[model samples]
Target: MKVLTANRLTNGEAVWLAGDHSWAVTLQAAEVALDEATEEKLARAGTAALLKNEVVDVALIDVELDSGALRPVRLRERIRAAGPTNRRDLGKQAELQIAVAA
Candidate 1:
């Protein structure tokens, strides 16, 4: 499977293309493409977003659904999903952990 990802131009935050056709911070909210047609559609949307200057570093990421959870195949994408490693208390890492704990 695949999912579209990009950095929001305004804040350089890693975001995913959601099912509602909006940008979302969490990878879990990203719309998963299970086939070529969907991947192509996501690619087109990513290109459009890039041209519109709404985001940068747009990419289609390889992913898997592990026990119904999203998991990026690459280490780099994993890091990106978790946010900056320097501050564990910040970004998606903290956000996800907090939600789980709550």
Candidate 2:
């Protein structure tokens, strides 16, 4: 599968393209394109978001459903999704851990 991602303009938060043409903060909520055609359509929508100044650095990324969890295929994307690995106490990973603990 493929997914579209970018950084939100206002806060620079990593975001994914949602089904309704909106940006989602979490990958689990991202819209997945099962084929090249759908990926192209999503890329166009991402371009629109960029032109409207809603996001930047928009790109299509390969992903897979690993044990029911959607994960990015490349290391760079994984870092982007999880946040800074050098600082485990920061970003999405930290937030997820906190949520799990609660």
Candidate 3:
């Protein structure tokens, strides 16, 4: 069982850790929205499971608590992490490929 880990910034942005062990922020547009319909579309498109166990914090949604201290709203998608596990194995994509040994 391979794992695909990524770090989402505090600004609602996502960065993927590539196979080369490098950080990249080149994800699709639909992956950043909090809309339910958008998430469904991503699931149909086979890109939903990429963000499993991902916690994203909001940088500018701080609010004053009862103690007169500011705290972040902390928007996150807990349910998205536990979606279908029947998708393709992203980690072994190259190894499962078909090579012509001519």
Candidate 4:
């Protein structure tokens, strides 16, 4: 994804595109720069990431066609941000339950 993450020119916060045509403020301190076309690709990717809750770095925030609307935030800097789901963890728990049942 081509996220165009940058400090908001006005508020100095990190913002990126999210799912449902919404924007999310990231907790990172990275600047994402890109051209007009690159911004579009990033935005689209950001939207997908949000819905999936995919783990993404603030710098990796894809800036899409409407990159201008996103604002960067300070919170985007948090390390090890998990995605929307933890399949492995869930599978482990399920395995334990099955073991008990058996």
Off by more than 4 A, model 4: 1-31, 55-102
TM-scores of the candidates in the order shown = 0.90, 0.93, 0.20, 0.26
lDDT of 4 by residue, 1-102 (tens): 244333334454445444333344542222344566656666566555555654343245432333554332322322222121345344223444566789
lDDT of 1 by residue, 1-102 (tens): 999999999999999999888899999999999999999999999999999999999999999988989999998999999977889898899998999999
User: What ranking of all candidate models by TM-score puts the best one first?
Assistant: 2, 1, 4, 3
Cα-based lDDT for every prediction: 0.94, 0.92, 0.31, 0.41
Per-residue lDDT over 4-96 for candidate 3, one digit per residue giving the tens place of the 0 to 100 score: 234454444434333343334432111232455643443332333334433232111122232652222332321122222354332222223
Per-prediction count of colliding residue pairs? Answer: 0, 0, 0, 32
Sorted by lDDT (best first), the order is 1, 2, 4, 3
RMSD of each: 1.5, 1.1, 16.8, 13.7
Pairing residues by index, what is the TM-score of model 1?
A: 0.90
Question: Residue 44 lDDT in model 4?
Answer: 61
State model 3's lDDT.
0.31
Worst 10 residues of 4 by lDDT: 75-84
Worst lDDT 10-window in candidate 1: 83-92
